[model samples]
Target: MTPVTSRVEYSPIKRARVYMKHEMGIPERRIALEEGISPGSVSGIIRRYPIQKDATSCARSGRPPKLSDRDKRAILRLIKKDPYITTHNLIVAAGLDVSKRTLLRWLKHEGIVHKPAF
Candidate 1:
């Protein structure tokens, strides 16, 4: 059987222990020994403590919006002025740099209904 290892590095439990050690002025080596982790791992945790303190397990992912609130408002105004404006026309009129699909998705997200080209 393999030997048991220390708690997972960067885990909440390990981070908490690292914080406690840091607060109590405990040495990295001692904390490593007590927690069955490596001194380097403990050191890394201590170094990153400040930044990680406010972090949770779940991190926000994905790219930010290409269009800002002002841009979105401009698109809304254009749509309001002419309800029959096509997505292509809207992109050109508003100087939006996003693709047609992205614009359509944004419109859908903003609850803007597109009229059929009947």
Candidate 2:
């Protein structure tokens, strides 16, 4: 039979142990040894329990918006000027620098509806 290792899938149990161990001032190296993970992983688990933390224990800045507020305003102005404008024409009219699909997603997210071009 293959030998069983201390390694465990990351879950609530491991998170609890890492959090508790950290609260008790246990060193990262020792915690890693006990948890069968890298010291970095142990530290990450400890940080994940904080009130403001997300997965990686740091503020996650998602992808920066491709269009600035000015660009968005321009699109809205273009729409106000002609609500019937097709997505392709809107792109050419506004000189948008994104793909058609990306613009459609942005429009959808901003509550703008498009009549899918014929």
The model with the greatest TM-score is 1
Q: Which tens-of-lDDT digit does each residue in 15-79 have in candidate 2? A: 77788888899998998998788998887777667753332233445577688888888889999
**CA RMSD for every model?**
9.9, 10.5
Best by lDDT: 1
The list of candidate 1 runs beyond 4 A from truth reads: 1-49, 52-61, 115-118
The clash count for each model shown is 0, 0
lDDT value, candidate 1, whole model: 0.78
User: For each candidate, what is the lDDT?
Assistant: 0.78, 0.77
Question: Which 10 consecutive residues of model 1 have the lowest summed lDDT?
Answer: 1-10
Identify the runs in model 2 with alpha carbons over 4 angstroms from their true place.
1-62, 115-118
